[model samples]
Target: MEQGLALLLALSLGLLQPGHGQPLHVEPPEPEVAMAVGASLQFTCSLACAGGAARVRWRGLDIGLGAVLSEAGSSVLSVHNASLSATGTRVCEGSCGDRRFQRTVKLLVYAFPDQLAVSPATLVPGRNQEVACTAHSVSPTDTLSFSLLLGNRELEGVQALGREEKEEDLQETEDLLFRVTQRWLLPPLGTPAPPTLHCQATMRLPGLELSHRRALPVLHSQTSLERPDPTSSEPPTTTSPQATPQQGSTGTPRTDSSTRTCRPEIHWSLEPVSWELLCEAACGPGMTVHWTLAPGGLAAYKRREAGAQAWLSLPPDGSRTEGFFQCRLDPGGQVVSLYVPIQKVIPKT
Candidate 1:
């Protein structure tokens, strides 16, 4: 009983001493901080104590380790080339007399996607073309979106692929890369005015939203041809064809000046004509009618003989045929036209 009373008296005396037992309060850095990769950051720990000497220290929650950043009354932690491994909760501890106190703050490090790009700088009109857009070096892969647009209109049936994750072992971080593709079937002449293609990328995250856009111009060629009048009464002049060597003839074949020439007439008509008979009469030896497109113009052709069951479709590679030719072209949506013409060449008399 005497020993127990002596211990109680000693504790009371210690408590009565001035500034022997004081409360310590610590204030950590901001509640949260965000920084990009390869950047620098600093965290501060503030302390308040009623008595006794006060000391401050910092520790990482993820690593469960403490390190001395500053030795004065306050503590400061500095990080360089901040990366994913540096992100987490950090604790600041302060001690005064026999009392200890701590506070915690969170750090977040992220990277935004790089700029967007378009493939095939130039786009040709009236052809099936593909445009590809790409973005690189993005973080937090899931918060990204990509799209293609023309002016304010969003293109339909576009193909998009992304989120190819890359790991960096040294930085202990992950990055993402993405791409989007669009297939366009341009009209023969495109729009009345040139169109612009736009590529966009968006990143959505808490407390932050980022977006980027890139534009490309579409180019096209235009052409027009004037049709000749067929009702004139004047006869065309005759020019002799180049003569080939004959077995018994010593001199080249010659044409008489009085011989009259019949020229092939071209016109745009709405009604279909007999192609087989027209071709047979117009395309004889040394006398033929040729078909061609105007400068900078593109067209597709379909043909039907006098007695054919179906119209034969011709490839886009400029083909020549003597027949009733039906040419079609598209300049833009809701605009299309067909030209049907027969070339008639008169045989040499």
Candidate 2:
């Protein structure tokens, strides 16, 4: 009778409990996610088990980020408009028989990028081209600024504005969404034809728990003005390595701890067979002007290194037929560069 009871108990337990050795599986295929602000993001939790009905649960739905859709054997967490508040790890769980499983999907929200786009692929000297930079689909237009530079000199009056600034019939939301456009008119370039025109867009986000990412968002774009070959410098060539200027007075006064600018006085005297070009940068005597030939190699420096005043004799023969003479000054190891034309050398006929 006892043996019969034990057999009956065993049968009952078998009928009540699920089959052993099959574990519940819960996972998200791609847990790491990045989405633009106001975009849609969704993830479904995977669940597997044997011999029992599977069920699922979505967590973090109460955070006001989005809604969760529960289906047969799986559940999906979705953010229809992913904002900064939606950037975090979203959790989902599932159960099969007595087994439970958990999975998390991380999401990130971003704005103020893609990249900075600048129009007019190349800039030419003496041409007043309107240069425009766009911070595509950025949020929070206020406090965002752009800076425009032509060969390291900041051009003024670049204003950062978004669609909301011009569209009078736009609705306001928690975060304003629009493309930022900043424009600056390229001045008649007097420095060099091949000026490095650089544009940068910078935006500061609020310091919050937006995925623990507090770093600022910035975008950059640049194009060089194709410099025409100097009437004296050679053909297209590689740029010379930047020479470390010394602290002594070399050409001009210090513009700052880092830069020095000079308006060099250039003239040439007559030699028998060749004309001698003389350029003076008055940082005082004992100052060696760091002469450089830009957009080409220094074999064009005329190898004629001099003090305060530097001279490069011209036959236009064994040397360059055309190139710009960049007069550089060093004060505190900062080299300021300015290109001068041979027009300064009025050879009196």
Against the true structure, whose lDDT is highest? 2
Error of 1 at 11 (Å): 24
Query: Tens digit of lDDT per residue, candidate 2, span 213-330?
Result: 1111111111111222222112222222322222222333333334444434444444344445455656555566655544234564354665666666542443332223445444
- Displacement of the residue 216 alpha carbon in candidate 2, Å: 23
lDDT of 1: 0.45
- All models: lDDT? 0.45, 0.49
Question: Model 1: which ten-residue window has the lowest total lDDT?
Answer: 329-338
Deviation from native of the Cα of residue 92 in model 1, angstroms: 2.3
* Model 1 / residue 218 / CA error / Å: 2.9
Q: Candidate 1's residue-wise lDDT over 1-349, tens digit each?
A: 9998976675575431223233323333346666776788777775665655667777784333333466756887776777656777777777666555666667776666455555433344555555555455656556667677766677664444433344433344443322332334333334563455666767776556787776644533221122211111121121222222122222211223475333232233212222221221122244433332221222444444332121333333433332122122111111111222223423222
Shift of residue 349 alpha carbon in model 1, Å? 53
lDDT of 1 at 198: 69
